[model samples]
Target: MDMEGEERIAAPRAVVWQALNDADILRQCIPGCQSLEWTSPTELAAAVKLKIGPVSASFSGAVTLSDVVAPESYTITGEGKGGIAGFAKGGAQVTLLDEGPETLLRYTAQAQVGGKLAQLGSRLIGSSSQKLATQFFADFNKAVVARAEQSVQS
Candidate 1:
């Protein structure tokens, strides 16, 4: 599946970029994320539980960031195994644009699944993916905005 979206965050590009890289914030923002930890400067290990259709599974994955350009853009790739449930692999190109006082965050992603997940039909998988992606970004935006507000008050 393929997806794209953009969000306007009420913070500077640098602040938005920082939040994007913060494992703690990501763990909080990502729906169903059980844990997210940085294994290296450009890599993260994560565990997540998800329910798609009537199937529920826990996935463990490693995410790698490449072609990084600091506060500007990067490509993130991840692969996860869900035992008999299936496996998922995907990549996204994310860009942060400075929009004066706010930041415009854009992303384009592609994903594929195999095993039981692939058998679930593309429509189910696509809609589920979109919902998960939307939830993550919405939560992330709220967290970032709240953090920015707190920093200003500090």
Candidate 2:
């Protein structure tokens, strides 16, 4: 499956970039994320529980950041195993653009699933993936704005 979208966050590019790299903020923003910890400057380990249609499973994976250009753009790739429920792998090219007092974040993503997840049908998997991605970005936008506000207050 493939997906792309953009969001305008109410913070500067620098602040938005900081939030994007913060594991704690990402853990809170990602739907069903149980844990997200950085293993290296450009690598992270994560576990997420998700349910699509009637199937549910916990996926553990390694996320890697590459083609990085500091606070401007990067490519994020990940692969997760979910026991019998199957496996999922995907990658996204993320870009951040300055928009006056805010930041415009854009992403292009591609994903694939195998085993039971693939058995669920493409329509189901695609919709579920879209929903998850939408939720993640919305939550991330809110978190970044709130964090920016908190920092100003401090």
Best prediction by lDDT: 2
TM-score between model 2 and native: 0.99
Identify the runs in model 2 with alpha carbons over 4 angstroms from their true place.
none
lDDT of 2 at 85: 98
lDDT of 1 by residue, 1-154 (tens): 9999999999998889999999999999988999999999999999999999998989999999999999799999999999999998988899999888999999998889999999999999999998888898889999999999999999
Please list all clashing residue pairs in model 2, or write none if there are none: none
Every model's TM-score: 0.98, 0.99
lDDT of 2 by residue, 1-154 (tens): 9999999999999999999899999999989999999999999999999999999999999999999998999999999999999999999999999999999999999989998999999999999999999999999999999999999999
In model 2, how many backbone clashes occur? Answer: 0
Score each candidate by Cα lDDT: 0.93, 0.96
The lowest-lDDT stretch of 10 consecutive residues in candidate 1 is 129-138
